[model samples]
Target: MIRIELDEAALGATRIAMSPLRDAFCAAHLQLPGRAPSWPYQEWAGHARAVWREDDRLRPLWELFTEGPPGVSDFLMPRPLGTPDVYEELDQLRATDPAFVRAQVAVCYPGMGEEPFLRPYLTDPQAACAALADAYAAWWEEAIAPCWPVMRRLVEDEVLLRARTFATEGVDALFGGLESRARWERPVLELTKYIDAEYAAGERRLVLVPLVFAEGCRLYSTDDPEVLAVSFQARGAAALRERTPGPADGGDRLGLLLGRGRAAVLRELAGPLTTAGLADRLGLAPSTVSEHLSLLAGAGVVTRHRVGRSVYYQLTDTGRSLLALLAGEGVLGTAAA
Candidate 1:
């Protein structure tokens, strides 16, 4: 659970610029999808605002940053936003209310005294705000909205899965050692290939990286699909046993319990095998077999596809990496790394 602190000004600057980028993207394509509210933008902004409002430690820093961009320096905050709901809802909003387009700007950045800069547009303030919407609408129809469906599919199915694995292992185990400055830092880039086979399908246009940060010295966060696993590590606790030399040792503590176990199971099931087939071969309960398969699949150790009712599993090209790592080999080969 690595959490990065963000510069509010940086985020505000980013938020202030988001509409232009979105519009410019749509404009470059030139289709005009019609007037519809963009929920993704709204929610993304909402999250920025939420963090500004909610997170105590980050709030002051963020506020100071938003107060002045130069003061922030080059605050390389992570590009992560909110959950899938943010994107999904944004898409839906765009489809439903074209007028809500300006909401994108208003949601993230604070206006004078709880009033957003977009408030005037909401109440008939005109000019640039309206122009932004019109331009964005054109762009959406031409490029974004059309490609959105498929883009969404990949995010929901694939991105979500890898995020789940990271959520489970990254923080819960990583921090068991001690706290560091990594918390309240910017989110790390989620290597697309690592996220899902069909990763970043549409991200060629927009950068999709994780935001990381720490809370002082004790906690960190890397947002995921469900709950953002913030400060979930067991810092200050007795040190756990070091991971034995194996593929599982690549990551932190959870990797040993999780990575090693999955590696051991997948090692046996390198060849094609059904769930029951695997359970029988491993001599473990069927339920235990299922759990290992889930983790291994997440780690890309194996692939699974439903054949009728029973799902069969096999090693992916990537799974070879896991196996190699476990064998004390380097990435992509069977040589001690």
Candidate 2:
């Protein structure tokens, strides 16, 4: 159990951020054990197999990242943030001192004499950091950037929900909403983990990052014991499996009831998605998807959020109820269930 002692400012400062790098690190778990069954993991597993099948340069890092090891490097995941700025984090990695990087590596992999791959980092930390940054960015571009739109919506929506909870249900409910492993007791926010430790959160910031790939609530802290970082399972995580098609229970009938294209749009929206995303997902023309979206919006079956030039859409309560009924009839997928 890790207990974080929160001050007034720490409590108020708690916020959510999207960490692409953090997600990448979490993806390393694919090489190890304890990976849960999810559509996202299944898709990621395919990608990892294809990417590392050949004698790729990333294969070494992939091997090193396997679980049951003493340690995995933490320099990649800097601090928790209330933003999804990957470039900013890469810049921080570039500016990190060689000694600090080496020190962290040493602490994580204490018996490094046998681990030859990590020797370069110990010998020349600057080059190691540069290499790590490059590797992380390359992996993100290949693995995560393509699906970021869906991933971003999942993280952002959870933050919004938590913010509303904090406002309406007060601080206790806010912590309760984080994860089943976390609970609030007065000044102490306890996280039940394999390890037991505590941090005194004085006049510092406590950043709560909701990561789509995080297996459980984990802690990261700054030099000042008062400042800490907590990354937990984001809400709607199951939706990350957006790439995997849900059960086509009564999809045909639903499509017949609502024109095929419109029904396809609604089915794809088992999770939040954009118009273009819907079109690509359904292999339909963007115009076709847009037209269906317009009709759905007008009919009060979906709600739209226009952010700049892009509009994200989700099922309205009525839409959800409709899907639920269809699901019960075994017409649609598990999305409604």
Pick the lDDT winner: 2
In order, what is each prediction's RMSD in angstroms?
18.5, 5.4
Q: Write the per-residue lDDT of candidate 1 for residues 151-261, one digit (tens) a residue.
A: 333223223232333355443232221233222223231211112222112122222222111111111112222222222111111111122344336554435645555
* Backbone clashes, candidate 2: 6
What does candidate 2's lDDT look like per residue over 196-285, in tens digits?
777776646777777777762244544423446677886545544444453354646667678767877886665456776666556668
Model 1 TM-score is: 0.28
Please, what is the whole-model Cα lDDT of each candidate in the order they appear? 0.35, 0.66
